[model samples]
Target: MGIKSWLSKPLASWIVQKQKKWSSDPVGTQKNVFDLLIKKAQKTTFGKDHAFDSIQSHADYCRLVPVREYEGFKEYIELVKQGTQDVLWPGIPLYFAKTSGTTSGVKYIPITKDSIGYHINGAKDALLNYVHQTGKSEFLDKKLIFLSGSPIMEKKNGIYIGRLSGIVNHHVPGYLRGNQLPSFETNCVDDWESKLEKIVDETIDQDMSLISGIPPWVQMYFDRIEERTHKKIKDVFPSFSLLVYGGVNFSPYKRKLIESIGKEIDTVETYPASEGFIAFQDIPGQAGLLLLLNSGIFYEFIPVEEYGSANPTRLTIGEVKTDVNYALVMSTNAGLFAYSIGDTVKFVSTAPYRIVVTGRVKHFISAFGEHVIGEEVEQAMKNALLKHPEVSITEFTVAPQVTPEEGLPYHEWLIEFISMPADMDQFAHDLDQEMIQKNIYYKDLIVGNILRPLVITSISAGGFINGMKKMGKLGGQNKAPRLSNDRSFATIILTA
Candidate 1:
């Protein structure tokens, strides 16, 4: 092993030990983060307007500050965009993470001087924890690729603005520069298809070890490699072992991707967003992501059912229970106070606080009385896949078919199949049965004749991919919605 690789294992051990101190006392660590953030922000305009000086506890904070979504919080973000300093955080933000929003056009999420670590070191700690657990540090010497958006950022109002992954791309530590693949020129290509071809060209002959990206995009890379070499990904990069993925559930795409690689590989799941780097899988093959309580963000949970109620219940880390869904809210050093980032999570374990991302708070199918979520639709697919081994898909989505020309309204399944089942009629039956088992309201609707059984609509080859490209949302942190109440996204595919 090289000298740097030899030293990494011990350093990994040290980092994990230090992190354990905070995880062992989750609530106390969060209390410390809360007090520190409040103390630092009291002099800022938001704090003063909300009477932050007199706030002493969660109850006091909740009374003084109402939870806000990005639309509700845009007034403050507008000030930062205008180069206003000390309007939210103590100083001007270091950078703004530019992200697309459905209801609110483009969102500019601030990354303050104090909160950059949550974006940078949080990824490092994830890798170090892997090394500490498996004692494998040799990948540090081989090539690693983070399939991401263009790292080239643009300046606006004297501050940098770009996608979160693109912004974080600029901060990769010096030590990994030699081992990272996909040259900066290749990375800056605006067209995702063209950029992907160049990435395969650059990395095909190198000694690859680590590959990270959303599952769909990773599958695209694997497809390109197979087309050129006529070999599985494992055959092309024999040393490849670790797969790091985030931003969407991997289970829906897992079966097809595993076949594309032609072998099983270790995987790490993460929960990262523009607002914060929330959690990651610390132990390989673990069911839940370990929440980072001691990071510069103080987290809160509102039961998903009570999220939009007039007086929603707010709970700290200690108050959360396992197996119940809750909307994630946090006050970060990044100047966001009681901010709900629109994601809901289920605590799989609370002894040390680990969670699973359930769905977006707004992404649900409820045109009728039945309000079904992302997790259920995903679970239904998982259940159906188990019964029919011949079934595999490129991607799929669910939407309420509220109006039909001939029959009662029903749910619609838009699917792009890789290997179609011999009988799609039976396949749809199995999927509908699974959905009914997971969601009772949908079952009641079907039985009462208010809704009919689901209809599966097939998208032609490369349809979803082309639709994304048409919208200029082809790659890098862009995810297809699992469930949308409206037909806009589904129409993009159905008409394609």
Candidate 2:
């Protein structure tokens, strides 16, 4: 074997040992991280305002700083934006991870010198875990592409600002730089279509062993490759072995992406956000990503059903139970305290704390009070895939039809198909059956005749793509919601 194949051996072993050290004592590890974060931020403006010095426990924390979203913390962020020092964390933030928001126009999440390693290490440990599990690393030496946002960034108030992916782009470890593909200039193109075309030109004929991106954009890249080369990705790059993805559940996109690749390959799922890196899948085929207990963050969870209450029951690591959905909250080294990042997760394993991202807090269907969530819809689709091998779905979304023109209200599923089922009525029947089985409320609604059986709307090929482009969310971390409480997305899909 070449020397490159051996490089991951020691690194993987070291990472595994380090992870085991923390995983072995999940509660204590998190406690230490919590104390360190609180102790370090005591002098900052936020800490002083929240009386951090007097806070002694999670109960004290819950009382001192109420749970909030980005808007609630915008006061400190604004202070930092105006050249305030020691406002959020110690000194000024090194970078602001600029990300889009539905309510807040543009959010600037702070990252400090002390906190930068969380994002960097989050990526590293995930890849190393893959290496240790598979006993292979030669993919590191071959050409690879990270289909990410442009690396180019700007400075605001003397702090660098860019997408989280772009901020991390500047920090790609030197060892991997040698094999990174799609030249920097191409990556900096800004316009996704133009950048994608340039990326195809740069790497189509070169050796590419790894590709990483959100599923839809990655699918776009594969489509472009097949269009140009007239070959499956497996045939074009036989050595390609790993596919790393995150930012969306993979089940809906799984069959389509695998077919494009033309074979099975190892895949890794990561849970990363501007707030912090939450988890990574540690074992192959495991149900959920292992939570980062020793990372520079203190975690909190509020039962999803109780989140809207004036005083919700907040639980820390040791207090949480398996299979219960909770709204993920965190207080981080980056200076977010009791902050809600809008994601919901369920712990599949509590002994070592492994969690599956169930859905987003606001992304659900309850127009008729059925309260169907993203996870239920995705699980139903997964069952559909297993039941109907001939049916291939490319993209799909669910929204409530509260006021149908003729009949009682119902849920509408818009699906874009690559291969249609021979029996359209039977396909809808199977999908509805799974959906009803997964969500008890939906089943109740159906039985009471408050809502009718869901209807299916077939979308032409590239329909969702055209719709996303129109919404200006066509690439780089953007994803179509699997379920929506409103008809905004449904309108777009119908028109597209």
The sequence of per-residue lDDT tens digits that candidate 1 reaches over residues 47-75 is 89899999999899999899888887788
My TM-score estimates for the predictions, one after another, are: 0.99, 0.98
Tens-digit lDDT track of model 2 for 326-346:
999998999898999999999
| lDDT over C-alpha atoms for residue 218 of model 2 | 96
Q: After the best TM-score superposition of candidate 1, give how far the Cα of residue 161 lies from its true spot, in angstroms.
A: 0.7
Looking at candidate 2, what is the lDDT of residue 165?
A: 87
Where in model 1 is the C-alpha error above 4 Å? none
Candidate 2 residue pairs that clash = none
Clash pairs, model 1 backbone: none
